[model samples]
Target: MGAVRKRSSADRPPSSDRGRRIRRSERVPDESGGTGMRRPIWTALAGFLLLAGCAGGEAASDGQGRPDYGEIKSMVKDILQTEDGKKAIQETIKNDAVKQELLFNQEEIKRAVVQALTSEQGKKTLRTTLEEPKWAATVAKAMQKENERLLRALMKDPEYQAMLLDVMKGPDFEKMLLDLMKSPPYRKQMQQAIQDAFESPLMQEKLYAMIEKAVESALKPGQKEKGGEKEKGGEKSEEGGEGGGK
Candidate 1:
């Protein structure tokens, strides 16, 4: 076998050396050089960060912006002033269910009113108002009208008339009347009424005629007996006197 010749550095394969050099040169640099193939990635990352920062700034600005309360209030006022809004509110209030609820709560409302009026302060206020002459007069006139209306209504009710008649005919009512008649004040009033009636000329003439008739009736029989006795006594007395003279 022939002795192999020593391989020299210059005799090394060009392909292997070239491949190693190419690999070394192809290694990505770190911060020492511009990104070559990664340029688009870096650019994309940078652009994303910038956009994020812009978005953060916009959010910060939105957070710092205050609401326009005055404008909001104006808008609300305008809405309320609209005809549709008014109609909606009116319709809600005029609902049949609302009316029924109000009717059902009427007793509660009346109780509340009675409770309030019965309170000391309410009573005092009412008294003060009623003490005013104008208020009192107005109340009196209203009460008079109410009483007249009630009287008219009662007069038109046959049942009410029957009830009244029954009450008047009742023993309790008779007792009440008898008690009133027995009272001293009632007796005085009745006597005064009688005296007033007798003061009339017609009553006085009737009374005088009744007394004259009563007196004539009482004296007629006695007058006849007395006349007969007087005639007999006078005749006897004449006869006695003639005898005495002889």
Candidate 2:
């Protein structure tokens, strides 16, 4: 009123300023909830969305992604079902080196077999089997046939027979026989056998027959006349001695 003020811009608030302040205050009310509680809820919701996005990104990556087990299994199954894969497996097992190793271990296998057969249980089983009549008979028959066949084959070999004869005729064999006969035990056995034979009744009868034949032969011809003269002389001497005594 004093200066009839021209109402310059600096003397009063602009109408636009009032409108802006009112809009700001209204916007703040809309953003905030009762006691401003919606602030934390909105912040937590934003953080959860950020983490979900990161997890989704990681799941989509190639190297760090989850494994596709079904795909891997299918691939493995396909490879194993192929002909080449089967052939490779078979060749590994049937390799020449494996065959050679088995061949080289044959002696070890034989030793293992001998050890097993020589064990106490094995001996007991063998004894039981041999004690069984049927089993023993069968084994004996087989062994006998084998022995007979071997003997026949050996007898058919002329070289073997010659070797046997040579051995029998060797000086070593003659020395062995002479040594046996010279042994004191052998001499005693032979003497006992001879004495037993001479003590037999048939030997005594034969000896008596031989003695009677010898006496008959000695008494023949001039030998019998000389025997009768000696007997008559002996009887005269006996009669002379008896008369002198009377």
Candidate 3:
């Protein structure tokens, strides 16, 4: 008889299996002999609450068959704290519709900002905040790095460099510079620098060396005169000896 051919696993039909796998969205059989359909968490939660009179019984509620605001808030908070709920919220926020809904017009934003800044309470708050030394220092410290980076970028820009040159060459800027140099604070700072130099050990050593060099220079001419006179005396003695021999 001819050999019977066996069908390979890969050649077999997909539906030939006896067992069926359950899909995530498919209905699951419950122990109560009923099928449990997959539903959204919020929908299931709302359904459960409605079935249980919102919050257990009438006594647990606001004397009504509905949950109180506090209970509802706590329930919502608990749901929001869950990973699934957070992921859902994040997905909802990332939706195009949500972005369009949240976005405000530029004119509206500008008007709101102007109103806020111009308001009496806002001005007072700003003035008080600025008047605080600690707050001012903290804000300056935070902005220092950003300001330096911005300045560095501006310095590299040709337009910014031209603008800076224009400002620097202006009479107002020159006056400001001169006024700063002539200020009492500037004089005091100069004095402090001089005092520091005088107090420095290196400066003191340099000064001492300078004084020794000056003294050596002052005494050098006297030594040179004596040496010249001794040379002349030796020359005269040599001449006298030559004449005596003659």
Q: Candidate 2 lDDT, tens digit per residue, 83-116?
A: 9989987887699998898799999999988987
Q: For residues 163-207, what per-residue lDDT tens digits would candidate 1 score against the true structure?
A: 999999999999999999999999999999999999999999999
Model 2, residue 50: distance off in Å is 43
What TM-score would candidate 1 get against the native?
0.33
Backbone clashes in model 2, listed as residue pairs: none
RMSD of each: 20.0, 22.2, 21.5
lDDT of 3 at 165: 99
Per-residue lDDT of 68-117 in model 3, one digit per residue for the tens?
A: 78988999999999999999999999999887776856678788888988
Error in Å for residue 96 of model 1: 31
Whole-model lDDT values for every prediction: 0.91, 0.88, 0.85
Clashes within 3 Å, all models in order:
0, 0, 0
User: What's the alpha carbon RMSD for model 1?
Assistant: 20.0
Q: Write the candidate numbers in order of decreasing lDDT.
A: 1, 2, 3
Residue runs of model 2 more than 4 Å from their true location after superposition? 1-172, 215-246
